[model samples]
Target: MANLRPISRVVQGQRMKEGAGVTICRTVGTSMLRNLDPYLMLDELKLPAKAAFAGFPDHPHRGFETCSIMLEGKMEHRDSQGNHGVIGPGGIQWMTAGRGIVHSEMPGTTDGVLWGFQLWINLPKKDKMCKPRYQDYQATDIPVVESAPGASVRVMAGEHAGTAGPIKMRNPGLLMDVRLAAGANFTQEVPEGWNGFAYIYDGEGKVCGTKAQPEQALVLGPGDHVVATGGSGPSGLKFLLIAGKPIGEPIVQHGPFVMNTQDEIQQAFRDYQSGALQRPEDNPWKGEEL
Candidate 1:
């Protein structure tokens, strides 16, 4: 029998505004939990219908990967590498900020609710300076499996019952988007000893014996399996169950830069300031205006 992992802690994300008044709920990257190995931070961005969401402007990042998943609405992405894309409902954009990259994410629509989640994943020390890359997936590209009536799972970055996410990662990780109808139940196993967490983005339910609701984050203990029960409501329960093997190394993070040591962090800052972050020849879109 697979033992169910219980929730060790439940933390409410702090609400804050960033990037031209864009509101977000930050769950990780806080004082309470600096990081969870390969994973650094998770932010939930939500904007109501008809309300203007002044999106994020150009920003720099290094030594990490960012995964953006859109649950609803639309978002436009433009990067310094001349990469441009838009993510709609059920879309995903996974960007690797190896070395560095400057990008902006803005709202594409104003008539409907905008709901999405952004997760930061740290890169290994050796691959910190690798070439930047992107793994974009549309809704149709993701595999959705109906485990049972009223219960379904969307494979975002891990394998489940032969369904795997399209995004390729330098480090191994799992991100599963789950949804359950009222009176439903779902159970699954996570890799033993892996750091695991689940963020309830919609509805209320019990995750691994802990009462959970929207905006709540559940940190899981060591065990093989996790159980989720849908709460008594029409919306049921919706959440992302994520886990990753801990990198087990020292991490030095200083505002947009996550490196292995203080010296590397300082070098990142110097490179950005001295215009040495990206060499002209390295740019794939150097001569193009984007």
Candidate 2:
């Protein structure tokens, strides 16, 4: 028996322009104009064979973290810390913007086509300003273990069965990039009280018993395990299985700013307006972001 997992309507990814890049999937998340706390927002970017679609110029971030994962092509990241590198295919870069930081992501070519995923995870209020750090985990550095007949799980956070990922953080969470071949099914447990959700990337499947398509998402009820079964794609189904322990605090976010209070959000805007938010002088790619 499967529960027709509760889900919102499926909407097409719209054309939305952001600071440095364009957004295809518009109107994301549950509420109309509000973002899910803890998990702010998730957007998808697809770049064709050409090189014109390179992403984000130098940008300022306060009180949040930005995650970039190259799904198809290559993405080069440079920041104020004087760090620069290319994340290809399965490579991922997790950056934390505590008090403040400035950085940029420029899309690149690989073979011919280019594709990837950029995820943003919110930082808890207490740990928000700790410090800014960059962790680039090579594809091989990420652990991928087989769980069931036709399913594979890539553990990015939290414990999966007996395996864990190299990408550790202060936030108690789990991020698994899972893939399922047709007819294959896999079930992995989640923390007893962890807040989690599953979003389909390639194919359709049943989420805990409800039917979900690549066009839709499953918010998932309070549970311990997420079940994804393959359906249509002979090419196989891809999804990002992510979960996080709730921080249980007020979230204040405005555009690129994410904080815990209205005063903090206002301060973030003021800082950026005063040019204090950009990467400092003598920093990596100084004065590069627009």
- Residue runs of model 1 more than 4 Å from their true location after superposition: 49-52, 278-290
> Each candidate: what lDDT?
0.85, 0.68
Q: Which candidate is the best by TM-score?
A: 1
Model 1 scores a C-alpha lDDT of 0.85
Write down the TM-score for model 2.
Answer: 0.86
Candidate 2 residue 272 C-alpha distance from true site, Å: 2.5
- What range of 10 consecutive residues in model 1 has the weakest lDDT sum? 281-290
- Per-residue lDDT for 183-252 in model 1, tens only? 7888877878888899999999889889989988899898988889888888899999989988888999
List candidate 2 segments past 4 Å from native: 1-15, 19-21, 26-33, 49-54, 279-290
| RMSD in angstroms between candidate 2 and the native structure over all alpha carbons | 4.7
How does model 2 fare in lDDT? Answer: 0.68
TM-score (C-alpha) between model 1 and the true structure: 0.94
